[model samples]
Target: MRTATVSIGVSNRHVHLSPKHLEMLFGKDYSLAEVKDLGQPGQFAAQETVSLVGPKGIVEGVRVLGPIRKSTQVEISRTDSFRLGIKAPVKESGDLAGTPGCMLVGPAGTVSLSEGVIIAVRHIHMSPKEAKQLGYKDCDRVSVLVEGERELCFHSVIVRVHPDFRLEMHIDTDEANASMLATGDQVKILGRTQDALDLVG
Candidate 1:
């Protein structure tokens, strides 16, 4: 069977801010300065960054991505959570229920968030047309095979399809280092669940 391919994008720890939180963190009328465009349409990395304060330690210079979201969220790696002394769940982006909380230090002020930190789950961002071409739907889970010095198969990868998204697979820094994967590396989609295993086997 012909498999779908996606470019890998290793995402470092970043923050997505809500409108209210943005004002509270920055100034009353501050706007994010676009640094670079992301894989997804209209999404960019802002010049702004913030410091995250946790029980055990503080993580500084966490890049803030733009444009602003409806709800604020902090995406960290498993190792970051350990360093911060938070037990953040590996959750899909924007699903912040029952997650840990942390203080975000910005230029204007510091905001204490009740809950929003997460260790982002590995996911593929694709357009609706791309999803249809691959015979997949939003929320469908699949596995990815990355061939390299450290060949690895990533399982339970969530599919997120939207009109605005481009074809890309997002993984944390830790995962990328473990598999010797880097930006621009290609990964093959190996169907869902058992079929995925069969592909690897």
Candidate 2:
């Protein structure tokens, strides 16, 4: 078994609202801030709270992504949009080419997507000693079986073996739920032809 852990990044966000919707939410005075890389056209500055006015119902507190286009997004809830004022329930950020997502948990919710939030999933960083021992190659689909008070098997996890990558597995909240897991908890790795033997990290 490989003695390493992997971590993955996962986030959920809504699509940016259109111009018409922007006019409805933030009055037409606001404009979109031009961003680079994954920034989609019509991407606007979200002022924290807005309404998602969908045909079905509305989701309140919808973060209005400025510079509205055709598809507007309501990030939080299928219900929030309905009770408040929104169009769709929950539109995935993937619908838009360049919009991103971030959530702040404490008392007041004030947070934005990180610089790399929109790009790809976060992975475990490794070192040469770690990689050679684990027999992991970049882009390898590796499955890890977790045994704790409860037993689970996580399958098809991507093993990113890099010279600089440290041994660890990355999982998101959603993925954690699938295995009923927790951080710092240990899992058993089963497979591969690598020969570095270490029972613990």
List model 1 lDDT by residue over 125-185, tens digit each: 9899899989888998888888878887888899999999989999999999999988888
Model 1 spans > 4 angstroms off: 198-201
- Candidate 1 pairs with clashing backbones: none
Q: Pick the candidate with the highest TM-score.
A: 1
TM-score of each: 0.96, 0.40
Shift of residue 32 alpha carbon in model 2, Å? 21
Estimate the overall C-alpha local distance difference test score of candidate 2: 0.44
lDDT of 2 at 109: 29
Candidate 2 structure quality by residue, lDDT tens digits, 132-200: 677766655555666665576655555565454455555544555666675555565564412112333
What lDDT does each candidate get? 0.92, 0.44
